[model samples]
Target: MKSLSLHFISIGGSVMHNLAIALQQQGHKVTGSDDEIYEPSRTRLQKQGLLPAEMGWNPANIHTGLDAVILGMHARKDNPELLKAQELGLAVYSYPEFIYEQSKHKQRVVIAGSHGKTTITSILLHVLNYHKRNFDYLVGAQIEGFDTMVKLTADAPLLIAEGDEYGASPLDTRPKFLFFQPHIALISGIAWDHVNIYPTYDSYVHQFELLADSLPKAGAIVFDDTDDMLDVIALKEREDVTRQPYDVHSYRISNGQTWLKTKSAGDVPVQIFGEHNMKNIAGALAVCDRLGITEEMFYEAIQSFKGAARRLELVTSNDQKTIYRDFAHAPSKVGATTAAVRQQFPNRKLIACVELHTFSSLNKNFLGQYRDKLDQADVAVVFYSPHTLEMKRMEPISPQEIITAFDRPDLQIFTDTASLQTFLESQSTAAPSVYLLMSSGTFGGLDVNRLGEQ
Candidate 1:
C-alpha cells in the first residue's frame, strides 16, 4: 500500500481518531472532521497532526485527490462531506469496512462478543508481540504497553481486531463485525445488549450466528464453553470450519492473587483475575495455539499483561482499602465484575458502585436484568443522573422502580454524583474494603482518581 490521501468524517471518536493517527503513521496524509472533539482523542489527534483545523463537516474537505473517505458512525448519511465524496465519485467506506479493505490480504483474527473482546484481543496482541511477531491490530481500549489502539502496516501479515457488535455506520445497520470476515474469530459470550437495535434476545444472538457462519470453510472459530447460547452456536461446526470451545482455565484464588494451575509451566500468576477473565485467557490461548503459539509461550507471555485500561482498572490501592473502576454498564458485565472483585478479596468488604449510564441500563424495561446482580457485594449502590435521562430523551425512573427491579429493598440509589461521592468516601475509609466503581459513562464527569484517594 502506497502513501495515500484520506479524509475522515466524524473522526474525533476514540476508535476513529486512533485509526486516523495510525493511517498517518503508515505515511498516508490523514485529515478528519467532527462536530466536537473531547479529551484524549482531541489531544492525541493534535499530537499526530491529524486534528481537523475546525470541528464540523465541510463539503470543501472532500475532494478528488482523496483516495478514500472513511465514515464514522457519528456522521449521518446526509453529512455534507459525505455528500461531496459521493458527488466526486470518490471511494467511501465505513470504518470496519475500510479496515477490512485495508487488511483483506492479511490473516485477520477478530475477537467478538458482548464482553471480553478488548481483554481477549489485548491478550492475543501481548502474546504475539512478546514473541517478536509483526502483526497489525485494532483493539477497542487502550492497553498497557500499546501506543495507539489501531495499527496498520504493509509488512505485517496478520491483523488482530476487537470486533464490536455495534452498527457500522448510521447508514449501515449490520453489526460492525459482519465486515471483517476474519480467518479466525472468537465469540467470548452472548448477552442481550443494544436493545435499541436488536430488540429481542434471539435477534441479538443471531448477529453472532451470522459472524460464525461468515468464516471460510477452512477457517476456525474459537468460543467459550460457559455461555450456553454461544456453546450451542460454536460447537456446531460448518463442514470444514474448526470449532474450538474453551472453559475457565484451572486456577485458584489465594491472598487476593489468581494463579493459573499449569501442568508443565508450574503455577502461573497473572495480574487479572475472575472466572470471566480466566475463560477469556483460555479462549485467547486457544486462538494463539491455532496460530502456532505454544501453551508454554502463552503462559510466559500472559503473566505480564496487567489489563486493558478501564476494564477493572485499579485506580489506587493499599492494605486498608483499594479502588477499581470498570467499564461495566450491562447487567452481565456488572455481575461478573462485582463477583470477580469480591471473590479475589474474600476477606474484604466490597463496595460495588455502578452508574446506570448506558441506554440499555437506563431503560425502565431493562432494569430487571440487573436483579440481584450485585448481591455478592457487601455494600452496593446504583447511580444514574436525572440530567442524563433528559439528555438521552428517556423517561425519568423513580428510585422505587429501581429498588423493586433490583429485588433489593434496601438497594441504595443516587441521581447525583456529589452525594454519591460523599457516601462512597465515608464508606470506603473503612479498612479491608474495596471500592469498585463501574460505568460506561463517567458519574457526571466525576474524577474517579480523586474519589479513590485516601
Candidate 2:
C-alpha cells in the first residue's frame, strides 16, 4: 500500500469517522466533509485533527490530489462534494466497497443478520485483541479496548465486519454484506427489518440467504441454532458452504456476575450477562476456533468482555436504582433486551420502556411482531414521537394500536416526551428497581443519563 490522500463525503457517521481516523493513523492524509457533526464524533475527529473546518459540503475540498473518495450513505446523490468528485473523474467508492478492497487479500469474517450483528462482531474483536492478534475490524458499536470502531492496517491478515442488511450506498441498492464476499460468516438470527425497504418478511429473509449463498465453497458459516428460520435456510440453500450451529452456552449469574461453563475451558466469569450474549459468545467462539484460536484462550479473552456500547449498557446504578439503555428497536431486539434485564434483576421491578422509532417498528403491518415482547417486564411502556412519524411520512398510530400490538393490557403508551419524562420521574427509586430504556433513536432528545440520575 502506498501513502495516499483520501477524502470522505459525509464522514461524521459512526463507521466513517473511525475509518478516517484509522487511515490517518496509517500515515494517510485524510480530509472529510459532513453537513452536521454531533457530540462524540465532533470531539473525536477534532482530537485526531480530522474534523472539517466547516459543517456543510464544500466543493473546494474535492481536488485532483485526492487518491480516492470514500462515500458514506449519509451523503445524498446530489451532494455537492460527491458531484464534484464525479466531475473531476476521481475514483469514488462506497464505504463497504472500500472495506472489501482493503481486505481483499485478508480473511474476511462478516457477521450478518437482522439483529445482534454488532454484539457478535464486538465479541470477536474483543477476543482477538485479547490474544494480541493483529487484525482490522469494522464494528457498528464502540468497544472499550479499541480506540476506534474501524481499524485498517497494511499487514493485518484478518478483517472482521458487521454485515448490515441495509442498502450500502445511494447508488447501490444491494445490502453492504453482499460485497464483502466473506471467507467466514455468521448469521446471528433473521427477522423482518427495514420494512420500508424489504416490504415483506420473506423479502427481508432472502437477503441473508443471498449472503450465505455468495460465500465461496471453502467458506464457513456459523449460525444461531436458536433461529429455526436460519437453520432451515442454511440446511436447504447452502450446500457448498461448511455450516456450524451454536446455541446459548451454559451460564449462570450469581451475585451480579455471569459465569460460563465450557467443556475444555471450564468455568469462566464474564462482565456481561444475558442468554443472547451467551449465544453471542458461542458464535464468537466458533469464529475464533475457525481462526485457529484455542478454546482456552477464547474463554480467557471473552470472560473479560464488557459488551458493546448501548446494548444493555448500564448508564447509572446505585444500591436502590439501576438504569440501562439499549439500542433495541426491532421486535427481536426488544424481546431479547427486556428478557435480559428481567433475568439479571429478577428481584427488582423491571420497567421496560421501548421507543418505536424505526421504520419496521412503526409500520402498521409489522407492529404485530412485537406482540408479547415486553411481557416479561413488570411494567411496559411504549413511546413514539409524532414528529418521527411525520418525518417518516407514516400515518399517525393510536396508543390503542400500540397497546394491542404488544398484546399487553397493562402496557402504557406515551406520545409526548415530557409526559414520558414525568412518568419516569414519578417512579420510586427508594427500592431497587431496573429501568430498561430501549430505542434506536434518542427518545425525542431526552437526556437518558440525566433521567437516570433523577
Candidate 3:
C-alpha cells in the first residue's frame, strides 16, 4: 500500500495515457514516454501534468527505484527503455498484468467479447457512479462522465474492465483478458476477428474457452445464449463456476424512445435502443445484481445513459436527414449497427457506408464473413483505402472482390473517398434518410460530416 514510482512505455495510447493519469491521481509518481502522441490523449496528459517533454523513449528515464514499468502494446519488443529495464533488473509488466496486480485484492468484473465490451463497461461505470459506489474501472473508449479511461483508488474494492481479447504485449501473445482472472465476467457474444493473429474461427474461439477456464471456482460467468459458440464454451468448461445465461430483454420502441419490460422490474424507458443494447443491458444488470444493486436501481441508472462515444454516435442532424458515425467494422457489428438505425428510424431511407479499415476487415480471406451484413440498408456502400492495404502488407483488393465477398449484387465499393463523397451528394435530399458511417478508422481522412451536409 506504500506510494510507488511507475514509468510507462508508449504511454500516449488511449488506455496507457489514462492509466498514467490514474496512477498520478492516486498519489504515485508517474512518468512516461512514447514515440508520438495524438490529439485528445496529448491534451489529456498535459491537463494531468503527465505528458513527457519529448516523444521518443529515453533509457535515462528508467531507474532502479521504479516499482514497475508498464509497457503498452504499441511499444516494440526492442524499445530502448524496455531494454534498459531489463538491464537494470526492474520489474516489467504488460498494462493488463499491472492492472491485475493492482486489483488483486479487489473483486474483478470483466466484460469480454468481440464487440459491445465498451458499451457494457460504460453502462456499469455509469450505474456505479450514479449509486455513489467507489470502484475502479478500465474502459477502452472515452465516456462523457468519466474523466479518465482508467481509475485506481486505494479505497475502491471493485475493479471493472472492458476485457479485449487482443494480445497483451509484443512479448505476450496471450489475450489480455487472460491476466484479469475475473471473479465475475460477461461475454457479449462471439465473432471471429483479428484475422492477422487469430487465423481461423476455431483458433479465435479457443481464446474465449481459455478465458472461461481461468475463472475461479466461485466465480460467475454471464453470457449471451443467442451465440451458439459462447453457449458451447460456457457449458463445456468450468462446471464449478456459476453460469448465467441471458438474451435480449423485452423492449418496445414508441415515439423515438425504447422501453424495457422485465418480469421483476417494471417497464423502464431507456435512452439507447437496439436489440443488441437490450442484451447488453441484461448482461450489465446481472453484473450489477451480483454487486448488490437492485433491478430498479439498475433501470433508474440506465434510463439516462446516452451511449459510449463512437458506438452509434450522432454526428449531425437536420429536419430532412441524420448522420451517424460508429466504430463498427466487423460483420456482426455492421449488421447490428445498420439494423439498429433502420429499426429506430423506420420511416427513413437508410444509406449505410462502411470502411474496411482493420487488418481483419481488409484481408481477402476474411471478406466473405461480411456477406449480407449491410442488407438492411436501403443503399449500401463499402469503402476501403488503398493505402490501408499497402500499410497492412495485404494484396490490393478490387471493387469487384469486395462486391463479390459481400454477396450483394447491388453493393457499391469505392477505393477513393472523394468519389464516394460525390456519390453521396447525388442522393435525393427530399427523402428522410439516415446516413450511417461505420469504420474503425477515418475514411482516408475524409470529413464524413461535411459529406453528409452536402
Candidate 4:
C-alpha cells in the first residue's frame, strides 16, 4: 500500500487514537484533530509526533491533497471537517469502513458480541502469537504482548478484529461489526446493551440478528449455543453458511485454580478463572479451527492465557485476602463476574462492590434488568455517583429505586466515592474474603492497590 495522508476527525477516542498511531506506524502520513485529548492518548500522540498543533476541528485542515478523512464516532455528522471533505470530494470513510478498505483482499475474522468481545479476541491473538502465526488484529483492550491495540500490515493474509456493537461513525448508524464482512465470524453471546442506541431489548437484540444475517453464504459463524437468541439465529443460518455452536467447556475449579478438560491435552490448567471464560475459550477455539489451527495446538497455547485487562483481572492478593477489579457494568457482565469469583472461592466471604456509571446502568428502565445479578456475593453493595447521573442528564435515581431494581433488600448504596472508599477501608480483610470491585469506569479515581492493602 502507498503512503496515504489520513486525517481523523476525533482522534482522542480510545480506539480511534490507537488506529491513528497504527496507521502512522505503518508509514502512512497520519494527522488528526479532536476537541480534547485526555491522558495516555495525549502522551502517546505526542510521542508519535502525530498530535495536532491545536485542539478543535479546523475546516482549513481539509484539502484535496488528503487521501481520506477518517471519521470517529465522537464527531457529529455536521462536523466542519466532514462538510469540507464532502465539498472537496475527498473520500470520507468511517474508521471501520477504512479498516475494511485496507483489508478488503484479506480474509477477515471478526469476534463480536455485546460482552466478552475483547477477552475472546485477546485470547485468539495470544494463542496465534504463541504459535508464531503472523496475523494483523484490532483488539479493544491492551494485552500484555501486543505493542499496539491496532495493527495493519501489507503481507498478512488474515485480519482479526474485535467487532464492537456501537455505531461505527456519525454517518454510519449500523453496528461496527457489520463493516468487517467477516469470512469467519464469532458472536460470543448477545445481551441487551447500548440502551442509548437500541432503546428496547428487542431492538438491541435485532442488531446481533442482522450481524449474523449479514455474513456471506459461504462464510462461517461460531456462536454460543447457550444463548436462546443466538441459538435461534444459528438455526436460521443459510444452507451454505457453516454454523458451529459452542457451549462452556467442561471444567472444574479447585484450590483457586480453573482448569479445562481438553480432549487431547487432558486436564489443561489455565490462568483465567470462571465458567463464562471457559465459554470464551470454546468460541475462540472454534474460530481458530476455521483458521486451520487444530484443537490440540490451541489448547497447548491457551494454557498460558491469563486474561484481557479488566475482565476479572486479579489486582492484588494475599494469603487471606484477594482483590479483583473487572469491567462488568452491564447486567449480564455483572452477574457473570460476581458469580465467577464466588464460584472460584466458594469458602471465602465475598464482598462485591459495583459502580453504576454507564448510560444503561444509570437509566431508570434499564436498571431493573440487573435483578439478582449480585446474589452470589455474601455482602452486595452498589455505588453510583449523583454527579455522574447529572452529567449524563439522566433522571436522578433514588436509593429505593436501585434497591428495588436488584431486589436485594439488604443492598447497601453509596452516592459518592469518599464514603464508598471509607467504608471499604474500614472493612476487615483479616478473614478469607474476596473484595471484588466491578466497574467500566474508575470508581471516582479510587486506587485499587491502596484499597487492597488495607
Candidate 3 minimal-lDDT segment of 10 residues: 445-454
> In model 3, what lDDT does residue 44 have?
91
Compose the digit string of candidate 3's lDDT tens values, residues 280-383: 89889888999999988888889889889998888888878788899999999999999999999998999999999998998999999999899999999998
In order of appearance, the predictions have TM-scores of: 0.98, 0.96, 0.97, 0.98
Q: Sorted on TM-score, highest at the top, how do the candidates line up? A: 1, 4, 3, 2
The residue-level lDDT of candidate 2 at 378 comes to 88
- Model 4 scores a TM of 0.98
lDDT of 2 by residue, 243-349 (tens): 99999989988987789987887788998888888898888889999999999999889878888999889899888889999999999899988998888888998
* Candidate 3 vs candidate 4, TM-score winner: 4
Clashes of each: 0, 0, 0, 0
- Model 3 regions lying over 4 Å from their true place: 237-239
Greater TM-score among 1 and 3 belongs to 1
On residues 1-454, what C-alpha lDDT tens digit does candidate 4 reach at each position?
8899988999988888999998998899988999999987999899999789999989999998899999999898899999999999999998889999999989999999977899999999999999999888999888889877999888789999999889989888899999988988899888898898899889988888888888887898899999998988878938588999999988988798888987788999999988889899888988999888998899899988888888888898888788998989999999999989989999998999999999989999989999999999999999999999989898999999999999999998998888888888777656788899999898888877788777
Minimum summed lDDT over a 10-residue window in model 1 is located at 445-454
The per-model lDDT (C-alpha) reads: 0.90, 0.89, 0.90, 0.90
- Full-model lDDT, candidate 2: 0.89
